[model samples]
Target: MIIDRIDRALDMTSAIVAGIDGGQYADASLCAGWTVRDELNHLVGGMRIFTARLTGTDPGGEHHDDWLGDEPANAFHLAAEADRAAWRRPDALEGVIELGFGAVPAPAAAAIHHTEVLVHGIDLALVTGQEKLVDDQECERLLGEMRAMDFSMFRNPGMFGPETAVADDAPGHRRLLAFLGRAV
Candidate 1:
């Protein structure tokens, strides 16, 4: 079920990336101080890193490397394909992954990966006027899961900020973004 959610998130992000125009890449994203291109590169690099960790292969670059190159959309697609394949492996969720923070169980790592991809995708979509592309049900599900966990550890600079208030009647994606400290 988690992997299925991840696949859906990847597909949604891929669509958002494909819709991005060259001129819009430099626009500011919901992530403070990060442009659209910066966010996209980070997303793609994260995918590669997760895939490498799952398959025991070289990630081929650092987290902040310029992975997008001349074709940002194409780069994202390639990374997504590899990431999906690695996550689909029969034994992928059987062990722990050595993340920069520490060794996290595979299921936890997958949840974090899903959050990264989905949140960043929403960030991009919001900035690019494509908010309609976000999956509200997935956002609601993730928001509930986050609320059930102790997510405060991730609330720091460059990660999630303190939770912001949003109207209860707001859309699911907007509520999730607000909970993650984005001013939605």
Candidate 2:
């Protein structure tokens, strides 16, 4: 089940990365002050950080931000390249990675990793004039997880009011973020 989730997540990331060349703005999302490019970079940069955690290293001072005053793609690209290099080390995934928030087991972190891919995949698609990549099955799994989570991580207050509801079997990424209160 987890493997399937990862497969879908990875596919989403791959498609978004490949489709984007950073030109479209009409279909751009309302990610606060962030442009589509900035949102893509933020999501990719956040991946770089989390990927480093999987490899037992500090990913500098990266953050999981929703807003970008002037976030740069080149900067995020450089950071992502460095993080990729770190993942090549022989003992990278040897120990339990300190993922800033907590020390989660390697296998269990698949869900988190899956979450990153699915959520950011949307960010990339929205920014780059691409279509949504998350399908129904993956969304259901992530939605279930989010509903059970405490939801202070990505749940921005402006987006989800108390009355807003997230369907358990809705689109994967949408339900995932909504469950976290980022249904924007």
Using lDDT as the measure, which candidate wins? 1
Q: Tell me, what's the RMSD of every candidate? A: 1.2, 5.3
Q: Give the C-alpha miss distance for residue 35 in model 1, angstroms.
A: 0.3
lDDT per residue for candidate 2 within 53-147, as digits (tens), equals: 76656655567553223434445445445544554456544556556567877555555666665766766665565655546566666767766
| Model 1 bad stretches (over 4 Å) | 156-158
Cα displacement (Å) at residue 86, model 2: 8.5
Give Cα distance to truth, residue 50, candidate 2, Å. 3.3
lDDT of 1 by residue, 88-141 (tens): 999988889988888999998998999999999999998998999999899999
> CA lDDT of each candidate?
0.92, 0.57
lDDT of 1: 0.92
